[model samples]
Target: MYKIAPRISQLTVRQVEQFRSASAWVNPSRSRTESGPEASIDAEKLFINPEVQQLLVELTGMDLEGKVFRARRTTMQQRSHFALMTDERLSETMDKMRREAQRFLSFIPLKEPRSEEVTILSKDDDIKAFDNSKFVFTDITFDATDQDRTVVVREVDGTLRTATPEEHDRMNRVYYEKPNRPVFPPPVFKDPYLQDALARKEHEFVLDWACWFYEPDDPAYVNLVQCVCDRTVDNNDFEVLHSTRHFATLVFYLALNGNIPPLLNYFGGQGRIRDCANLVRLQKRLLPNWRFAISTSDTDLKIVTDFVKQNSRFHEALKDLIAFLKDGVILSRASPKVGSSFSAKAVPKVHISSLLISAFYS
Candidate 1:
């Protein structure tokens, strides 16, 4: 008999919420079913799994998991103004973009000026109006009471309109009420995890903003590169580097944020020769087809040679460098394609020095 391994399934945050809602409906005992003292008593006995509890706390912004319940509220307002030098050129460009958008919208005949509504069974029903158009549609209520479900639509300005009933009754079923998730009032940062995630997102946003504002070869690009280098150096985890999938992902993110230089610098840096050699050895073992540049620069070679001559203990470094150079030469000859194919198959078994050598060659 063959043994079957349990498969891991990943769920999206929204799906997880739906799962929780469904769980509440399915397992009535897990939720408060009654009113008054009985509900409170039942709630005390209903134990939530730690993971679900954490997710609920995150989603609701109420720390009601376990004994640590912290209520937090936050509100944000942003305002900015730019004073132009009364230049007609800038104004003209702005007007042109607006007019272009308007003209593009005019091609779509969906803009019914009269206050009216049109119920749509599915997105396909609105396909005719998909062309650029400025129209307001609102007051959508899904009617779940009827066997032939339908969406009741009303214009925001109060005109009512009805559409043909949908054949699918499931479409009208209310999956769950949108939770009135607690909104932090003002001047408050949420949980540390949330704060960290938000900060990271903001940093990425700023990097994108800068990239769009400046040319690719701008000095800002160099700064961005340096910043990534700093982060790589600071958070140099050898274990993560050893995993090709993990390392590639990290590199991809850094590259996407326009910070590849730091990664290059870290790989080529003289300080981590042993680590680099190990990395190179590992890469060669895992991805034999992939070629990496090992620094054969006179300055680096001479430095290695001098260090070996002065310190007997550093002879290992010389050996690693040689191995790295050998791998680089092989890769160069092979011209192994860059990216994942090279990473996954080539068993990474080289020493840190090999990585350094590969970086130099690169």
Candidate 2:
């Protein structure tokens, strides 16, 4: 039924011991209120975006353009804000979204049915993976409506059943009782059924993470957060606590206010251009059509583009070769003659952001 038992836990006994001794491992950037420091990825400052201005006009027929943050709140204020985007039609505040998400989580149908509209949450995967005691998991809800449309999942041969009143109480504790919840740190299977049920559905509609999630207790919490992240075989990887928060942030923005944009599609943490060549082959196996992309940072961009551009020249038969991410980005492709097809083209990242805005507003 399985190739091997997945590592019992992402943390070995040694890793947990390391955290117990350290008073506090400082994040180099400082500004660590919680959830580690804020993400300093790319040109994320989109306050003065011309594209966003244009988008507001085209969609709302109003001059409602400027920094996306509320007029009352400052940019720094918005940095820690989880529900960063809003509209009257969608959630208007972080608390509102959290309530909606918690309500959704609390929903357990009276009768479970097996239909695409309903997902049987995977129930046999690693246990205790998502039992973190910080940050509410209520991030974003896709095309969410003012309805109580809840969801659940099950094992291959399991039956879906309704949650009793007591069961609901227990589930709430698991989902919301963060500070009070204790991680026994061992063979104790505190909540096996709950963890499996939360394993991302086979074709789950949304993959979200609590931007404010940071467990102060687990000293080595950062790595533990990454370990608990769901890596679905269906390609719905929720890699929060690291290099992929941008994807979730984008979803929060677009789906709530404007048309949902195509995801920037992370091809997993290929280690910041450490494996540019191998990335091409892996991406080919995963996603072939969405070939163009921006990597974690400019250093990553260089590693990938530099290799591909040089490889193109070695062919001798192929000349006038151009790399795709020269402007600072990384990409992978499969070419018959090139062996590992990769490219880079100088693009004003503003243009990349602009184009992404265009696609969504369109």
Local distance difference test, per candidate?
0.30, 0.28
Q: On residues 1-362, what C-alpha lDDT tens digit does candidate 1 reach at each position?
A: 01111110121223322322111112222211122112111111121324322322221111122111112222654444466646787788667655553332221011101112233322223344444432332223464233322333333334323422221111222332223212211111223532343334333333333333322222333334334323443543212232111233233223222232333323323233433333333322322233333454534444443333333433342443344333321111111112212111222443335544444434
Candidate 1 residues lying further than 4 Å off, grouped into runs, are 1-270, 291-362
lDDT of 2 at 102: 36
How does residue 250 of candidate 2 score in lDDT?
A: 27
lDDT of 2 by residue, 52-123 (tens): 323222222111112112143234644443344447635455456444443333211111111112222224
Could you tell me which 10 consecutive residues in candidate 2 have the lowest summed lDDT?
A: 107-116
lDDT of 1: 0.30
Q: Give the Å shift of residue 75 in candidate 1.
A: 17
Q: TM-score of model 1 relative to the true fold?
A: 0.19
